[model samples]
Target: MPSRFRAWELCALMLAVGSAFTSNFAGADEKAEGDIPAFVGKDSPVGAWEYGKERGEFWKYRNEKPTATIDASSVGKYADKLTPGQIALFKAKPGYRMEIYPAHRVCGVPDFVAANSEQNKTLAKLDASEEHVVDGVTPGVMFPQPKTGAQAIYNYLLRYRGVGTSVSAQVTAVSPRPGSDEWITAVGPSLNYYPWAVEGHNKVVGGGAILNGISFTYVSPAALAGQGGAGKIYFNQDAEAYYYFTGQRRVRRMPSYLYDAPQLGYENEYLVDETGVFLGPPIDRFNWKLVGKKELYVPYSSFGMYRFNAKFDSVFSKSFVNPEFRRYEPHRVYVVEATLKPDARHVAHKKVFYLDEDTWIPVLAEDYDAQGNLWKVKEAYPIPVWELGGTCDFLAFTQYDMATGRYVSDQTTIGQGKDVRWFAKATEPWMKSDYFTSQALQSRSDR
Candidate 1:
């Protein structure tokens, strides 16, 4: 096994322009794209050129959805082998079909578990809505043995991801037109700071209500370039989000920015809470129910999605991300179903999430409309962040608009020369608290 790679420094910046990225293929020794060496995890089964494994004629299906028929005759044999959402997806007949791979263990953070053990000597309960953690919150998994759906989701959402992560470049793409080989892409840099998620520290640092603070600046698509802002994910309340508009030259609070709000770019393909499947506050408008566990083919060890040297043409298909570059392992996942409350409102009336049992990171999520029709399906690619003591994180994810066949993919280093920088400690200047405020957001805008 390869040794864990060290965290990259913040100085290894990617130029704000999309043209600054390179698309040429790389060899086995394609290390150190900039000041810091790129990482593919210690236990990853591939080299720098994971894209070399793509099959011949795979590109032939670019203009169409999955050609294979999936019905009672085809799905009968595997009916019991997959989740209801996965089954529903099969019926939807996507361009890419499911491919199951061998299961493996995804590493977890040691200090996080240690801190979780120390801080949660007495586990706490959720608030009246059973969404927010009322007490006993710490850096690691919020609920080790979660009996409720809310607790399981809390475990998935609050898992320690080092102090935070500094993304060098995450490219988001909305699927292109049929027979037209063009993609609408966005390039950006993101900073996430966990106020109380610092490792080796058992107690909360900042207010626990504010779990994480994140800021983003996009540098591509000229119209929105140099625009950025910051926000905080609260424990019980809606997030506090602010955006600094380069055109306006001012910072404005996004009062209604949380949940189902379409992102600024991507032609309404990306939503505010769609990233990572669910970045919304826990105590929002859903009533969560523990749906037990199931063995499903979930994305795991997705080194192909992290191919900083691979071209976007190799991964971004018309309807969905190229299935050849995606890997699915058969593992037990904690299934949770969330439904809109009696008086609640949102675009998605129902949401179901499949979280990896070991790492607690959600691998697949399905959203339903008010009439119980499958609306959107999302999948996240998990790669071990070896620098953070072999802990796991999802830097690549995609959401498919089931209705229009349009899809939005993001948090990827694919085709970019640099990779997302993971930090085991909060040492960067941007990871501080004040930087996430609206005032700091205005001063920090790239304009």
Candidate 2:
């Protein structure tokens, strides 16, 4: 049986989320940049220095890591702004650093959506509670007010990043074994497409059964030189993972690779749902509670981490990723906590995520083991996807195992010449569902 909040408790929690909007949201007119309700930082409007760089800044960050950094001695100044989980992580992995940067604005989902947002109106109309979204919500956020824990996490789960995105190359890195400096690493390509992603798209495709489809193939190291897999992330279920097995010379389904399963070669350092901080299954495994919307040090406008050209050695480290490659900013985030269901089973007993309020991206998270001990801490490296019309997306993210002193980074672009390519429409040939089928996986096998 799943634990649930009492009716009155649920109402109070919902009110907490609403109060966040009141405390953080500037007036609509002030927050609006030109015609688009430009999303900047929460609790503060965009600074003059942060405006106008919307799309260019994203690319510029990719080309060059930011030069300015917060002084190491002054890191304590941000102690009050960090979650207890983060402070615990700092203690677990000492010598972590922060890079301070301006929170630039991005043209948001307001400009190209058909969702029913604030009178069928938007992120700008967070006050309008008169049913502002379609049952089959597409393009824009569904619950801008986000009354429940499920609603808030759903915003993250469904936030748009265009119709399709393809990263030509993505690097993976895990810390060295205990008492040694050598590291485990792999590289691969990532593909994601949303069948119901097109603007005015979806009247609930398959009754909102499918949120997106993903495919990936890794070609590196002798052990994993030719492994590939495809999975469908449905609206309310576990992902279906399958891949072509080169040695077997056929596509095989991996049903057990659903929740909490460690990715091959990661040594249990990374779990399936740990991608981009929190991604698939028993997505409803816990009873969610909306803690509050609060200001915290979260990864925002992180371009340095995406430099496909950055040297791998510069980023991967014995404890956490190099502090220079990771940036932290003061932004408002919706804090949601999940406790495992009484009848459910998973390695993590409790989890907390601070989702960036502006983009609903989970910027920071903490996972607790079955003993209720904080086991891991995580962060996502998000840069505004200018290509996705300012809708932000994370290009890289990682988690640290506090118990083991190991960290695994996924979806990184460092050393790859190209970054994630965001599409405004499903125009590519491989954007179809068939491209993710087992037959397709076999045809595209590395071997």
Candidate 3:
């Protein structure tokens, strides 16, 4: 089961990173940045100033390691701004289901067609009585509100899927296309247990425990290939923690593996790259900045699910790992771009993230190449709602290589539900460092 129980919250107090009591946090005004406390006397192995140390488990895993610590208090500070409904939703025990659908009906105008002599002559003289108007209007002109990548997904979850304040299931099925795998099914137990799985490389690679309706899994790229492998992860249910039997090595949740750095506006954490590689150590560091927001059209948005899913072989090759080959300056968020300090470690070229500010979620990301060219583009959209409140971060995404016209998309499916206790009990024998090796994955059952 993927642990999505606000893991940052649990670790917040220890690292003093996400404490709501702190002043400098997300959504806070820029002026407040100056008033933030510095990392002077904290016992963090990775001080705020020395965030991106090039040594430690984090370094070995991420290769570059984190250059700075993230401010833990920031989580609480920003979380406070959430509406009561949003807060309740975030804290809800019921799992959530997310889905994505591609809408066909491209641009058109029914009224325009009806008034156009050319269109009426063609239709009236032909046996196309089966054709309908645009949204009930004659000639069927489409409304301008093109279903955006995120909105297309959100609407399906809220409307067709029956996702709301209560539990429900929704259809997330899509026709199997030519390029990618076919659509899969998922069900949640009591709106809390959500099952999201991914079939990659002609193999079932990503899926995990759906305990008490909430769990998360980060399948390794190796597993995505249907190869015998796993990924490192963080998960919780019913107040207990369980480390997944997979992921890149060197991930940990202990104080020794943790660091604090108020100076960086971050605390109590290590950093990892897209491949599940950790980027920082107990002694690494980097500088943090909250760049302004921007709207963007990311590639592989849900709108193209139907057409793109069928074009898999044409887009990706077995050797493709970010074949898009992008880079960045500071940091790389899935969708939201954040700039990093020049001296930062483990980060690609300077980058920008197209994150959904409303959900603090990312949808599309762009990476620069060594030459600072727009080498790669990664796009993701939310899945439909069946469980887990029907609202999720992203259902799937595709990374594209503009130079070679090659790409790879990771589509996902939710899984069956389970009890929260299942996760709590599972956590009893787990350790943060256990995920760093292949032997650790083999020993999960015994643990």
Candidate lDDT values, in order: 0.68, 0.66, 0.26
lDDT of 3 by residue, 105-173 (tens): 111111122122122222222012211111111111111111232221111111111111111221122
Candidate 2 clashing pairs? 116-120, 116-132, 117-120, 117-121, 118-121, 118-122, 308-415
lDDT of 1 by residue, 1-447 (tens): 011112231112122212211111011222443222332322332234233333112222222332233343467666665666667666665455665554545344553344343334465567776766766645656666677888888877777677788777778788875567667888888888875666443433223356778988888878778888698887656678999888788999998887888889667778888877788574468888989877666787676787777888888767667777777666567889999998988889999999876677889889999999888888888876656665778868887777876778888878877777777777888877688999888777743
Q: Of the pair 1 and 3, which is ahead by lDDT?
A: 1
Candidate 2: deviation at residue 164, Å?
A: 1.6
Winner on TM-score between 2 and 3 is 2
C-alpha lDDT of residue 391 in model 1: 72
Return the top candidate by lDDT. 1
TM-score for every candidate vs. truth? 0.80, 0.81, 0.33
Instruction: Give the residue spans of candidate 1 off by over 4 A.
Output: 1-76, 88-95, 118-121, 177-182, 204-209
Q: Write the per-residue lDDT of candidate 2 for residues 276-360, one digit (tens) a residue.
A: 7887534657878888877676787676677666778787778778877777666667899988889988899999999886677
Candidate 2 Cα lDDT to native: 0.66
